[model samples]
Target: MQPDDVRRTDVSTSPPDVKRPTRRRALVAAAVAAAVLLPAGAAVGYAYTGEVPRGVTVLGVDLGGLDRAAAGEALRAELARRSADLAAPVTVRVEDRTARVDPSAVGLAVDVDATVAAAADARPGVFARLFGSPTVDPVVAVDQGRLDAALRAAVGDVGQPVVAPAITYDGTTPRPVYPESGRVLDPATAAGALRAGWPDAREVTVPLLDVHPATTTADVDRLLAELARPAVSGPVTVTTDRGDLPVPPAAIAKSLVFAADDSGRIEPRVDEKALRSALGTGLREVEVAPKDATVVLDGGKPKVVPGTDGQRLDTAALGRDLLAVLPRTADRRVAGTLTAARPAMTDEQAAALGIRERVSTFTTNFTGGLSAPRSNNIVTIARDVDGTIVQPGETFSLNGHTGERSYAQGYKDAPVIMDGKLVPGVGGGTSQFTTTLFNATYYAGLEDVEHKPHSYWFSRYPPVIESTIFYPNLDFKFRNDTPYGVLIDTSWTSDSITVSIWSTKIYDSVKTEWGPRRNITKPRVVHLEPGPSCIATNGIDGFTQDAWRIFRKDGKELKREKFSWRYDAEPRFVCGG
Candidate 1:
């Protein structure tokens, strides 16, 4: 072969001088540039993309490759289809009763916006953009209030109210009523289960919760066993400083009270008011009232009687002690303290009452038949009116001082003037005492507040200067107008009654002037049936008279007072006619 032919064959056989390293370097640089450029391009595309990544699903509905608005529309369309499934009423079973509930009425709704957002969030990363995204569940919202309301309405008619335990006492025995349990739907739990299974399952079982009563039968039983039985087991004896009072078991039982405390426990106690009432009458015997000092006439001179201190049981403290001891087994005893009560008027105060000398004296005579009853009545009145002190600025009432002269007060029936006629009545001779007291007050220059005259004129009493008094209806009142206190002293004999006023003399002298009788009225005779109650007396003519009282100091007239009296005619009554 020739040299050129050999050279060509060598060149073909020597791999033609190929640059493999350079080719490999160029391929590697091209691959690196493609990795960076592709990722950067994808990032820019993702930043500007308005569509959701691929393979995203909401409630099993595909929402991929769609814009936000388009995704929301797709989710809403899928939810609307699912809502058709929810249109079928779900059957709710509670215990033995069953109710059909509409999901829409209970505020069951789909959140399309949230579902779309969840789908968007499930988008694949840039590297994973070539792959599928993860499956996501849509967010569902429910109105809890509306759901609970619908559930309550479904079970309202079938539910029973819970009964609370109670205890009632019937005199000697205590009865207890047991509590009853009630069933109600648990709104939260039942709603969660219902919402999770809604638009899919045709029926759902509602969870039932138990309602417990505040009190139970065990509580009542515990009260009866621990408190009531022990309280009524035996009698309680309450002993004070004076004596012991035995209260029977029945009474103690009535006083026992079983009440609930703040911790819901029944506690035993004694009824305070009932126990106090039971001991009221017994406590009265242990009480002593205070007596004020009195002013009395001793040998025609004012003397002070010393006041006395009183003692009374401390009922409140005794009640507390009794409550403490009453719960014991038997023979319970309690002692009460005696509190001292001071008298209103002390001996020194009584001595300071200015009653030094006799200011005035007056006497009235009764010349008629002085029967034993009439004499007894007069003596009784004099005894009552004697030793009564009239303080300064105080008014003395004859009727108030001398109470009603009934047979209960040891007064005998005698002749008394009534309806212009003398009739048989109790306290017949009291009018004479009134007249004497009035005249004594008049002569003493004391002020007279109120007084009434006799119905007819009488020769025994002064014409217009006398006064008469009956029971509560007619009263003789006089005010002590002096700066010093005045005391009344009364005495009576068989024929006359005397009333004297004792005080510091304020006036020098007192004189009275009388006017002649005028407007005379004749008496009329009347016949009456004879009986034991009939009374026969002489009648008198009626007239009007005027009198004046003149008070003098140091022989000079201080003041002059005028008084007028009008009398009615008294007709004579003839018995056995």
Candidate 2:
């Protein structure tokens, strides 16, 4: 009935770690217990008294005798109270921005009943039974409500459902966000985060492309409308390749649309205005069809070669048209010019020609001296018959283009030019033809790309004056000087071998006049053993000459250039003494 008795019982039953109650409260509680206990036996009295059971107290509130329902109700109220107490918006900082959200946003709930239930599991033991009344055990369930509140407070606002805004990534360089599940966040994820972080966000339509062949803007608009509703409660249809795809309205509304940009980049977004605008534009019509363009090879309609019946040149035309299409002068347009230019040769001419009608040529193998005291222009004229043209970017191969020299190709055995002396030979006197072509190219201002010098001296071909042709190794090559293609024209007579270069020229006139051989330097002497058959000729010694050419335009000299030539004397020997 007294404080001393209450103290004796409490001390015996109280947990060692638990602090004793305040003296005033302890005394009053003891008195109340005695008043009720004196009438009934101590056990019955305490049971009926409904006094504060021995257990842990939370904020001075005892919750010992309550049943499960009552305890649960009480716990719920406490959780609600705690939630309200912490209702003040929590300010969370991420990056450079701060966000505010209520603690309840993170799902915090409190249950006093659970704590009581746990406490009931921890009943007073033998010590309490021996010395004092049995004490109620106190257990605490994790304050899920409070914990959630704190977590939400820390996390800021997360709008919609727990899994509301899902992120879709275009697989581009998207901003990074870490998901709780340790996955990478895509654009859709970023959108979801934005929704969770921002409250004033309005509904926006995200335009998405259909994977199917056909889809209408109205269908997409309807889907958007359904998503824009207050709370998406049911499934909705979204267009797909297979057919309409039924998806949650909430998912659709907050869903990010993936659309390809001009660069084929998938962009995830949810802009209703932009979405509607895009859908209105409709699908892009197929642009250019796949087909082969006609290009003429050589000129005229390319003749189907004997072996190439079903095949034709890849291009529409060749020669002039080809030259026009190739990289050309600054002012000329390749495509336009090629379309307008006519084929270089007629169809009949091409069919008659062995190779197409562009140019026919053959090489000469001359073994004797040019202008051999016995050899003359007749042999030279007869050997000259082939012609050629230098297309842009083409390299001139004298022997390859001219072809081999043989009896089968109309070549006859005659005096030919070789190392300075005349002799009975085949394909002789071809140098005149080569020299003539060389002069033409030189006068035409074309590039003298490759040329071989004669092995012996020649009055006709002073150094820088002659071009030699050998079956494969020796050659004379020149590039066309004008933007317009150059055509080689060859004609032969008993007295002359003429090789003319015909092409369009920008220059009104190209004239060549020899400049005085100036800066005369002494020639270097050369000595060598002579062969037994070699004949020593008088007055033949090594000489050096630097000659100048004055190129004239109309009448006036436009440029003056020098050409250097070095000659070594031939050694003489007696064949028969």
Candidate 3:
């Protein structure tokens, strides 16, 4: 044979799989070159030249043999749904409970650019590209810790709380309440499931496990058989020093009660008030009334008044006897006793408290300026503050004593400070009463806990020392710093309201000193249309000032405290907009 014929025979004997791929590529290259040369085949040549490697796919959408731009467009179009779903928050369910979680908050995201680039990078040999189908997993970023936290929050309270055993009275009979089981969710497993399923799904349901309570049905059964059943079985005769008292089954049911602790153990407690009430008028005849000592204002000074003590049934002794005799089916007789009872406030305790004289008094004159509604609000607040007694070491809260002053609470519409102008608002003109009370507390040498000065200076109030109050937010509070009890006495007329603090005088007198103003700023004028909502104001200049409180004893200064404030300018508002 010739050399050329021998070489051709050798090539033909090679494997068909390897030989076929090489031949096919050569033929395609020849066809591409031919198509480029021909005038009408240029478009087809352009299409085949820039195509990606065959058999490449991303997320199940086929992108094999397509150009780079087309591949990217198709990839983005197919993944648009998952991308949007990833941005939206997902809801997680566990039994009846459900909560929402944001994928971004949990550090979960789909990397589209990276995924497309990866698909572009796939370049295999011709045979493999033709015969094999390759899949590119999309790029997904996940933070394990953040994902766990989000899933944990989303699965909050996934289980029901265990119910403990208890007992209740059914009119004259005792009934038992059995314990119940519950379920709990597994957060770690839920997070793992979400990481795999999210973006593809908007809702995930986690599995739950059973949980048991500390107290069981057996405990309820034991309690019912041992204590509850026999206690209300028969009548119990209670004997006081005077005579015998009858407690029937219904009364015993009212008196007996059981409480369960955290450890699920039942403890019996006596309702002394309920037992006395259930005794049915027999106890009233045997018991005597006791009086409490009180302080009264006689003439102009406060005086300690004496009180009396009386005889009453011993509650502790009665409880012990009743509990012992309850379990017996026969001879249910309990012996109780009458003992001497003391008043809540003894004469010695009342005498120890020093409330003898008028320590300080302040009166704000509203004589000519206040309207009828304002006067009514002032008098109403004054009546609420009257007869109030402040014990030693107690903090008095003005807001706590008087709740939100609304129309339903008997306050009327009047002028109030708002936006640097006087507007008609409900519960207006109450600030005058607040300022009066503040001055009274100040002169009494009490500790000011909290107080806010007016935004602009008012000529009617003492500069830098008075206060303004609004409901819920702004409040006037003071601590009674003295060892003596304080008696707050308020009196009002049509024109003025006076608040007086009465106690044994510790300081001779308290006085205030003003400081010169600084940082003065001029006010601006503004005009608005005249309407019911419009409020006109004569603007005041802004300034910073200080005040000093001087405490005196025996005509000499004891101590002094400094208070400072900064005021804002009140703009001149012309109601003609």
Give the winner by TM-score. 1
How much lDDT does candidate 3 score? Answer: 0.79
- For each candidate, C-alpha RMSD in Å? 20.7, 31.0, 21.1
True-structure lDDT of candidate 2: 0.43
Lowest lDDT 10-residue stretch of candidate 2: 176-185
Alpha carbon RMSD to native, model 2: 31.0
On lDDT, the leading prediction is 3
lDDT of each: 0.76, 0.43, 0.79
lDDT of 2 at 418: 43
The candidates, ranked best first by TM-score, are 1, 3, 2
Identify the runs in model 3 with alpha carbons over 4 angstroms from their true place: 1-164, 168-292, 306-343, 367-371, 528-530
- TM-score for candidate 2, please give it: 0.32
User: Which is superior by TM-score, 2 or 3?
Assistant: 3
lDDT of 2 by residue, 234-289 (tens): 34333322233332333323333434343233333454443223333221121112
Tens-digit lDDT track of model 3 for 272-325: 888878876777767777877767777877877787887788866787777777
Q: Which regions of candidate 1 fall more than 4 Å away from where they truly are?
A: 1-285, 319-331, 367-371
**Candidate 3: C-alpha RMSD after superposition:** 21.1
Q: Cα deviation of 351 in candidate 3 (Å)?
A: 2.9
